[model samples]
Target: MEQHYQLLRKHIEEICVLTDEEWDVVAQRFTYKSLKKHQFLIQKDQLVPCEYWIIKGLTKAYAIDSNGKEHILQFAMEQYWTSDFNAFQNKVPATIIIDCIEDSEFFCLKWEDREYLCHEIPKLNHFFRIKSHYGYIALQQRILSLLTETAEERYNNLIKKMPKLIQRVPKKLLAAYLGVTRETLSRF
Candidate 1:
């Protein structure tokens, strides 16, 4: 647990330095948890009150359409912070589902703690703001790829960006994420 906390500290310190006292205060607010593959972190229609920073393993955020097809919005891996952002920020019910793709460990921070820390520690605000910006940029790139790129093109780009994903994530999930069928993905 102490080692995992150090990992979180290192992730934050990359954005801004935290004093020992400040780090202590920040660390105390988070609760650590572990989840098995197939466990749901945020289920659709449930209230998602916390955000999580992945310490190990992988997860996916997706929405199921009326036809019961899953459309993956994003993948969260080690060092990434993920949650139903709309639900966490607005205190609303989740529209997307987040589930573990592999056995995972995370540091969870409740909304109250996050709000308080953002105000109590200005550097923490800087850290979160930077992460948010990068998240937005990634979203934009994903949208552009979905709008214009062929599924094969998207698959190639995804492989280039995350070669290990093909090995780690199930092909069906990867196919859904790439807007291709599993058979189509196999051809690539």
Candidate 2:
């Protein structure tokens, strides 16, 4: 957990500069946790109590379709945030699952704690607002891609955005993300 602190501090400072004293205040609110490969951080239909920031490793947020097929909504790597946003925001049951893809370590920031911190540190409000804006833009692009892009095009776009990521994920998971069979992803 001590080792994870530096990474978390760095990520936050990149978005909003913080003095050491301010950082100490910022860090104190987070709870450190670790998860093994395939372990779930948040499961469908459960209440999401916190949002996680990855210190190391990978996770995927996904939903199981009516046919029991998994559809990957997002893959979060080091320095990324993972959570069922609707559940977290509304205090409702989760509609998706967030699970580790590898042995992972991260920090969890509870909703009430986040709200408190943001109010205490006004800069944090700006920081989160910027992050939320980007999240919206990315979601829009994803929706557009799903609506109109071919699987190969989606693969190419992912490659452009996250070249290192494609190699790390299993082919089957990549296929799920692309909304295609493994064979189709391999062809791409």
Maximum-lDDT candidate: 1
| lDDT for each residue of candidate 1 in 75-159, tens digit (9 for 90 to 100) | 9899999999999999999999999999999999999998889999988999999999999999999999999999999999998
Candidates in order, TM-scores: namely 0.97, 0.96
lDDT against the true structure, each candidate:
0.94, 0.91
Model 1 alpha-carbon miss at residue 71, Å: 0.6
The window of 10 residues in a row where model 2 has the poorest summed lDDT is 1-10
* Candidate 2 lDDT, 1-188, residue by residue in tens: 66789888888888899988888889999999999999999999999999999988999999998999888999999988889999999999999999999999889999998998899899999888888888889889999999999999999999999998998899999998888999888786
> Candidate 1 — which residues are off by over 4 angstroms?
none
In terms of lDDT, model 1 sits at 0.94
